[model samples]
Structure formats: C-alpha cells, structure tokens
Target: MHTIASWRRLLAEFLGTALLVTAVVGSGIMASRLSPNDVGLQLLENSVATAFALSALILTFGPISGAHFNPVVSAADWFLGRRTGTGLPGRDLAGYAAAQTTGAIAGSVLANLMFDLAPVTFASKERSAGNLWLGEIVATAGLLLLIFALGRSGRAAVAPAAVGAYIGAAYWFTSSTSFANPAVTIGRAFTDTFAGIAPASVPGFVIAQLAGLLIGVGLLLAFYPDAGRSADDIVVAHPIDQAAHRP
Candidate 1:
C-alpha cells in the first residue's frame, strides 16, 4: 500500500466519524419524535444501520485512513502495533482525535438543527450509570479484541467489516447502547438526540473505555506470540485470540 499523507488520512477520519455519529444521533432524534413505544426497536434499527454503513464506509476508506473513526479505537490500535507508518506520529494521533471530535460535534449539532432536538439546560436527563459502565467495558473490550484478532490473523484487510460487525452486535449485547468511542460520547453530549449521553456522564464512560481497551489490548497480545509482532514481520492471516478460544 502506498503511504498516504496525514492530511488525506485526517480527512477520511473526519468524514467517516462525522457520518457515523450523524446517522446515529440523527436517527435517535427521529425515533424519539416518532414514537415512544417503538424507541426500543428504534435503537436496534439505528445501531444496525450505523454498523452496516460504517462497515461499508470503513472498508471503502480504510486504505487511505486506517478507518479508525473513533479515538478509543485509534488509541487501542496504537498500543497493538497497527499504523500506516511507525506510530502514525504522535502529532497525527492528536490531529486525528481533534478531527474526530470536531466531526462528531458537528454531527450532533447538525442533527439537532435538522430535527429540532436541541437539549435544554433545564431538562432532566438520565445517563444510566450502571448500564453505561457495563456498556463501556463490553464495548471497549469487544472493539479491542476484534482488532487484535483481525490484525493477528493478517485480516487487516477486513478491519472495516469486522469492526462494524462487532459494533452492530455490541448494541444488542450491552446496556447503555454502547458509546464505544470517546469522541462520539463527547459529541453526543451537545444534543438531546438519540443515543446521546448526558454531558455530566461523559467522564465515567471515557475512563471505563480507556481502561477496558488498554487491558483488552494487552490480553489480546498475549493470545499469540508472533501475532503481537509488527505486520511487516507476520505472514499468517486471521489468527484467533486464544481468549476467545476459551469457554
């Protein structure tokens, strides 16, 4: 693969992240306004739609951008030895986070304006602590493990689909509906849109995700000795995590 510049990668990151968050938040707003009773089904619908769209977009753009789209996922990728170049540069990581964050904010804000779902300062809100914590742990662990398993298997080629699939399932499996990315979590805070987490609650979710991702990446590495090595050094494809092999 020809090495694309940081600028191109950043553009891809911004657009991809924006698209994912917009669809999620936008769908949420629509669902809420449409029917309170169908909200449960709406959540599932939005998650699946987002996941499938993300999978396709990521696959289409992964070659140019690494398709991180999420700051938490990018940080995990950093620890797991995945990057276009050595580390994608510390500066680039900061840029990617900034772009992802900005895009998510724009996504939420746009959705709010489009749908009239702006959050009022005085509005009573629920952030769901117990469910959110469980979500953070489950979402983070699943994301990191998917990356690890895919990468070690030499399936970096299919990261988009694998990642999207993991996320799609996470919404169903976890509570709090899986705010898997810090950027998305923060972005969603500005809106009362669908899938939005209260601004006051963002910190806990981020901490949980970071902790889970860090530990999960390490655990993922231990699944295979050679698998942990740089992709340049490995030849095998699609190695499964031994942890996943356990009952």
Candidate 2:
C-alpha cells in the first residue's frame, strides 16, 4: 500500500517519462524524415535538438518526480538514501521494468501520431560493439553522479538544469549516443526514427547501464564521505550561515 505522496511520485514519474520520450523520439523522427540521403546532417541536428529539449524537459519535471526516467537511476537513488519507501527488490525488477516499458511504448505511440512519423527503418546502426557497451557504462555513470552531487548535497534546486546539461554533453562525447536512459531506449525500439536503437539491442544496453550505475554507487561512497554529511544540508544552511556571519 502506497502512501499518498509516494503514489503521487510514481504518477509523476509516469507523466515525466512520457513527456521525455515524446521530445526525444519526436525530434528523432522529424529529423530523419527531412533527409533521404542517409543519417548525415539529420543525426547532427538530432543530437543538438535532443540535448536541448531533454535538458529542458528534465529540468521542468525533475523536482516533482526526481525525473528518473530510467530504472538504474532510481536504484542508485535508493542506495544513496535519496529515495524513500520500499523499492522493487532485485527479483521484482520485472514489474518495474514492465511499468517503464509500458510507459515508453505509450509515449512513443503518442509521439508517432503527433509527429506523423513514417514507417520504421533499421538504418545506420551507428555504434560499434565495444563503443556501444562502453557508452552505456560512462553515460549512466555520469548521469547518476551528476544527480547525486546536486541532489544529496541539498542543492536539489538546480537538479533539472544539472541533469539536462549532463545528458546534453554526453550526447556529444559518448560513443553509444548516450542511451543513458533505460526507458527512453526501450521506448525508442518501437519507432524507426532518427533516435531509435534496434529492438534487439535493448537488453545489452540495459545491462551496460546497470553495470555503470553500480560502479557509480561504489564511487559515490568514496567521493562523498558520510562523516562530513552536515545537518545543514540545504534546509539548515541558509539561515545559519547568515546568522554566523552577522555582526
């Protein structure tokens, strides 16, 4: 039985993820449609637009939902003590994965119609095997670390921008095209837009992202020491610092 707040948080996740996939997949579809000479300029345009839209979207919905949009991120948050209440145990991730998959499919369906997307195509499989796996690892790790730094430090106010900026940057630098998001990647499978990953590849991507998340968790413990976790968090910092410096 979920408390009211927890249920709201869950619904928020659903809504936020749907919106996120819409922007990402929709942009991909539109870009591909404009050019028939392969994914040349289209991919470049797709990358830039996606980075901006995703950054804004996360910023908009992050506060209300933590804007997870990906299961691995939530798991890391759980371990970091940022997420409360019960989470799906390891064996029960199927239910959570199902929820994410369903949400992603619904989102992609809506975007397809809204953008008038064309028939799906498995074109330009841009990533290499080694690069693909490594991209997932680094991308997820970057996103988690960015989230944890801003969130756990009580600086959650800037979380949306911080998260968005990170994804945007990863898009440019990361080889696997930053499929840091498990939900978005799954949602993308149903569409043959500029943004889609081959449906067959989803499982491998998820595994890599999860491994990256675990590695991030390990690093988080080392980077952010517990002994220094102050009560001032954000809540207690503001007025105290003002008072301390007061003459």
lDDT of 1 by residue, 19-89 (tens): 88788877776766666688677887787777888788776666666677788766655544544443344
Summarize candidate 2's per-residue lDDT along 59-162 as a digit string, tens digits. 65554444566778666644554333332234324444555566777677777778765534342343438778998999988877776666557775666666
Number of clashes recorded per candidate: 4, 0
Tell me the TM-score of each prediction against the true structure.
Answer: 0.83, 0.77
Give the 10-residue window scoring lowest on summed lDDT in candidate 1: 232-241
Clashes of 2: 0
- RMSD (Cα, Å) for all candidates, in order, is 8.1, 7.3
State the local distance difference test value for candidate 1: 0.70
> For each candidate, what is the lDDT?
0.70, 0.64
Superposition error at 198 for model 2 (Å): 1.4
